[model samples]
Target: MLSNTTPSGRDVLLPMFFIGLMFFILGFVTWLNGSLIPFLKIVCELSNFQALWVAFAFYIAYTVMALPSAAILARTGYKRGMTIALGVMAMGALLFIPAARTGLYPIFLIALFTLASGMTLMQTAINPYIVCIGPRESAALRISIMGLFNKGAGIVVPLVFTALILSGMEHVSEASLGALDAAAREAMRNDLSQRLVFPYAVMAGALLLFMGLIHVSSLREPVLDAADAPADAAPRQGLLQHPQLVLGAITLFGYVGVEVIAGDTIALYGHQLGVAHYGVLTSYTMGFMVLGYALGVLLIPRWLSQRAALAWSAGSGLLFALGVALGSSGESTWSQALLGWAGVPAVPDTVLCLALLGLSNALVWPAVWPLALEGLGKHTAAGSALLIMAISGGALLPMLYGHLADVSGPQRAYWVLLPWYALILFYALAGSRLRRWSVA
Candidate 1:
């Protein structure tokens, strides 16, 4: 549990704004993978499974380095820890320059891993810091406010990045490349690869600027006290004794896996569904997420508890998945109506359901963080690291989805999301309430 002594609204206003900026940065860099997947597939000539390594390399860093990130935060505190994380991300961004120059897929993967390592550290520091700064009950609201910035960046980055590097990419498929001579193919790949250099250099510069700002800012470090320890538990029990934390970690894993599938895979799904302007369609998925986060910020802790919000979000996900699977075969009047309303000529029902998944996913993270970390007290940092590690779902599950897409069709591969959402719904309804471990 967090301290009861809530700071005045004015005291935290600036820090919260800065923290939101960090979330924005996190979203901007992280969600670029959506566009990068198809971009790299074209530039590097990758198969479906090979292109999905973009997500695997990016998200697996959380599993690999989250505990180390916790250790780094323990030593440096949140203020300095965030600064270090930003500096590390800047370095990772700089690596893109050479990776783009070489056009090597492995080097690009390395850069993504390095960048995600920094994001893992940044998340490990900021999530708990946000919860500790304010009343615990309102943690979801604060996180939702930050998420607006986060998903807002998600909405923008793909559009801007695709415009910059992937204009006319729909025409650059394997069939077209095969029609070209060897030198022409190399020239095309090299041209596509070079487009990434200037944008990433600008990213490197922006990250360094934010690093300097965070270093000089006076963000307070949270102090854990003896009161945070469980009253009935032994003096030094391990985290495994806490059933809620353990279950919550699994819940988070499922949530992230499904969320990544919804957001990152939308463009690819659109492509498979034969949507011509799939990049533009993908942005709508994130736009719906931003709207949902805005709603969360308004309603959480005021009209709805975080747990209730999570339950509703999970239920919505289940419903959406059912709709996607059952309604995808042929378009109904509703799909046509929706497309007409949006002034688009046609959209497959599956694509619309995938976009609406943004609404289902928007509240899960904010809700899950508070539920998972609640009552961990002194173990909060470690518990947070564990939850962050579960973000490996984003890495592994997408690859699984890709493989399934190759085996079956892309539309049917979404069956994989149904089971993950069922698990999250279980967590929202019961698993989050199973807090058997004492936190005195």
Candidate 2:
């Protein structure tokens, strides 16, 4: 039984490298929104509520384009679909060149939506590919490692955005803007927006280069065979009978909502507290997320079951959410408790708690995918798209949090995260196990 369930070690070697590369660049692009939330708030002169539409525009594309992406994948196959997706992303990157020059918020949004559309397609293709490529027992670990590539954005994205864009600004603070008269403010906004041009130009070039590399590369589509199919469901029927898929989508909806709130909002949270260099604060969250994924990589299946890992993640999320809402607003003593010796900037206890949400969020995605997609068989592609559509949680939830922040204060807005984590916890303990709406 052990021999039958485990795959040869060499089978996963090739797919892992290329897919890991894809996930890394994908993460590099996605987490830039964290830095961008604050950066764009400055450049576009947006209110906190209005500024979070950056996240709304980027993530909503996943919901909006996911089904179409699946259809394209069916016709074009995964390899061609990935290449096409990258090319679309390249075009989206180029759009930033003009949006930045004009200093228009709407154009930046269009650029984000376009970029996310490509990612929607890429995500629809890659997620199931990764899951099916390895032994079922170790799928979470494989996906966890893939997650490290994505979460790596925590470290790399901020430095790139801050050094490239923020470096051009003489002073980047609300207090400095308050001192400016109308004309200077407009001039300053235009100057700050234009600095985005070079970085986006470089991103477009890198995207196109990767597109070509994928077009010529050796990444083969993984074959999904009888051995990989789950016994629980018929392959060709509609997914209505699969409560796991439905509940899984709901789980992801809340999970992505909390995840985005944690990753994207930290910089803005720091900005509200008037922390120096608040734009880099998202990296702290990403750093913790990377740590969580590292643990997932090591302990999953071998030392931890997927269910146990997810249960721990959801519970910690609740604790961290509490910390964010009610923790001290004072100095930096506890910051050392997390990873202080590494030179992560000291933040208020409340904000550090928010960053620690990354640790809580890290395993939810890795654990949820396999549980949801198990036994999906021919519906795997469709199941993947449904899960991808769940990404809209990031799109809608943050806008509501932003509105709440506008009405209440930023710290008060964190109360919104509590219920979502609770819902995710429910899924971990019991929701993922239900097969039918009616009790047996």
User: Runs in model 2 with CA error above 4 Å?
Assistant: 1-8, 168-170, 226-237
Over 4 Å off, model 1: 1-4, 227-237, 329-336, 339-346, 437-440
Whole-model alpha-carbon lDDT for candidate 1? 0.84
**Candidate closest to the true structure, highest lDDT:** 2
Count clashing residue pairs per candidate.
3, 0
Find the 10 residues in a row with the least total lDDT in model 1: 227-236
Residue lDDT tens for model 1, 1-440? 33456577765787788899999999999889887887788788887788899999999999999888987877777789899999999989999999999999999999999999999999998887787777789999999999999999998998798788878777877678879999999999898899999999999999999999988877766655564422222332567777778888898888888888888888776765667766666577788899899999999999999888988898899989887776754563655776677765466887788878899999999998888887786677788888899999999999998898888877778888888888888888888887675657
Q: What value does the lDDT take at residue 7 in candidate 2?
A: 50
lDDT per model, in order? 0.84, 0.86
Per-candidate TM-scores read 0.94, 0.95
lDDT per residue for candidate 2 within 1-440, as digits (tens), equals 11244556665777688888889988999999998988888777788999999999999999999888988887788889999999999999999999999999999999999999999999988888788776767889989999999999666898778788777453576668878999998888888888889889999999999999998988775555754432223343466577788889999998999999999999888887877777788888898999999999989999999989999999999999999998887776778675678766678899889989999999999999999887666676788888999999999999999999999989899999999888888888988887777876
